[model samples]
Target: MSHSLSRLPTLATAAVAAAIAAAEPAAASRAVQSRTVKINGVELFYREAGPSNAPTVLLLHGFPSSSHMFRNLIPQLSERYHVIAPDYPGFGYTVAPADFSYTFASIADLIDAFTQTIGVRQYTLFVQDYGGPVGFRLAVKHPERLQGLVIQNAVANVEGWSPDAVKQLAPFWKERNTETEKPIRALLTADTTRFQYEHGTTRPQNLSPDAWTMDQAGLDRPGNDAIQLDYFFDYQNNVAAYPAWGEFLKQKQPPTLIVWGRNDPFFTLKGVEYFRNLLPNATVHDYDAGHFALETYGDEIAAETLRFLDTLPDK
Candidate 1:
């Protein structure tokens, strides 16, 4: 009897150890994985996490940023969804060739190709800043592939433009001369890059220096400034397509979630209203953050995103 009782305790301990060993794989699976894939003749570096068969969330980053912008949010969402953030050409570790066209349309095409190359037929798009134009173009091209949209400070409405930015951008938009290029190029400075993450956050101290440092490193790459300038000049094309994007939203009525930082000096609250006008049922959450809301409110955004995804009919 004593032998059996001792054996039972040993068996129980073995089972407990086995259970922990089993759990480790799942825990390890949640860790973000970095990878690179060649798409459209350029090597596109991407961060991926979660199961391949799970509902996918494609994170499209903004200007002066890369997939690094979604670094914190990816792990949070990966627990329940497949999260992928790709660095577009001229950003992050993605290689940008001198001959490559740095227009939003070209970027959109690259992303679309990247998705197809990786076998992501359908997904929820998370867009911010430059991602607005790239993702919207993809949405317009392949409306059937979109499950939903999560827009963060991505503007499509005319009302969303800050007067100060519009005034400053007007001269650059109209002409590409040295005089016009000076102010636009000034925005590429380290101060402006840092300001993007620190400007309107409630707790600037909580912001990481690594965010701006990584972005500045990417921006500082040789010939990257000219690529940025080319894209800046081409931004008008995105503006021109806004009406079409709005029309697509009205026509398809894809489920949407808008999380905006009210203090964002670039795209304002007016842009959220424009989205609401299109996706009247879109859940809106405004934070007291700057352009890079994820820097300060990543947890909040991730929680809200999970909640929103859970409530989706297909998910």
Candidate 2:
């Protein structure tokens, strides 16, 4: 399922309007370059930084956002860890066939294909938002491909959501109704993006305008709104896959770090507890931040992540 951008509300606010105007001139000045990779017939657009042979870190974004979400965090990490962030099919610069079935499992296959195509045999995985399901699917299929795991504001359990979001989706869980449910599915916009950052973070106003603008433009792209809505609907089944995901962790035991936004709106702090219990060797950090901790506390979180990596005796 795909949606046209016409359904998304246009940002006419003075602040947002001004940011877009300012970004236009400098957009060409930005140094990051993007490339297209074909996998299973889907064309994926991805941004790359750092040396190819450097320690690899694959970053995955969630719904209503893209690799664009990592605009700020990527450069910082690239200095140390070779970074690759791709816009999922139907999101960012990637384009999904109008008839494609946008399931989490399918996305995992694409991730695996992209990595192999790029000659990455092993690398760390960083997951956020929908990245939980998508990245986890990759983990389940190719646990050996993962070097380590870092999660920010991703749900490892169904128990991590706020009561409001759970309740809102409860009805659609029982029945399949896109027309009656589309509006609610389309609810995550700049307003909700702001809400997600503020409510999910310990500090909200620290967000950057460039980061916000990239998110807005990617979601505003034509035909993206529907894909987002479809993914929201697909998330209902994500819970069913959790038990197997947990089982995979128990069997594989990938060294894990939990960088959680203490105030995440969708996934509560309980997710930290869940990962801690599930992975005996996992280390956890709760930041006074929201869903996008990197946006609010990137430097601190990145430092913490590097510190954690350093503690690995073999690294």
Candidate 3:
């Protein structure tokens, strides 16, 4: 009888361990997946998390950044929201064909195809820097596909752009000459990339060097500079689109949330006013950090994003 009892204890322990092991994979499945899919012959890289059935949140990164910017914010949202961040043709790990057009319109077209390929019929868009141009283009092309909009340091109104950016870009926007384009090249340096991530945040210490490390690595790749320049020249199209996007916002008024870094050097705080005026009902959350507000204020931003998301009328 004692022998049998001893065996029972060992068996109970084994059963308990097996149960624990089983639960681990479930949690592990929640981890973000780095994946790639071909769209128009380009290999697009993305990070996805949360259940396939959950409402989708499409994250669009800014200049010199990629889906990696959302690394901290993704897990925070993955439990309740399906989050996906893709590296545009000229950015991050995505591989573009030599013959692919590098204009913002073409990039948006591929992303549109990407959504169709992934079977995501609708989603909320989270846009930053370059994302502003890309996301706004997507929104204009197919306004029906937008479930909501989450704007982080992206502007639809040209008046919202910083004067320096507007001034520096004017020549390039007018004509891509050596004199005009030469100045723009300075913005592509590692120093500028690091500056964008570190300049405005309060917690400079915690911000990972890896953010710029990875972004600069991607930038350093052959022919990538020209890809970025094409986008820079193409940015004029996004500027011309301000009126249409503004009108769309006024008409659709999709549930809007604006999270900004007030201290940003590239994009001025004045830009926030344009959104406020257009989206009087839009919620705005401003942080003292720089361009990459999420780097230091992620917990706060994540909470605001969740609060904003829950209040949405539907998926």
Using lDDT, give the best candidate's number: 1
lDDT of each: 0.91, 0.78, 0.88
- Candidate 2's TM-score: 0.84
RMSD of 2: 14.4
- Compared with the true structure, what per-residue lDDT tens digits does model 2 show for residues 201-279? 5555677767666677776777877776777678777888889998888888888888888887778977877888888
Report the alpha-carbon TM-score of model 1 versus the true structure: 0.97
Model 3 accuracy (lDDT, Cα): 0.88
Question: What C-alpha lDDT, on a 0 to 100 scale, does residue 137 get in candidate 3?
Answer: 80
Each prediction's TM-score against the native? 0.97, 0.84, 0.93
**Which ten contiguous residues of candidate 1 have the minimum total lDDT?**
306-315
Higher lDDT: candidate 2 or 3? Answer: 3
Q: In terms of TM-score, which candidate is strongest?
A: 1
By the TM-score metric, which is better: model 1 or model 3? 1
Question: Model 3: what TM-score?
Answer: 0.93
**Residue clash pairs of candidate 3:** 200-290
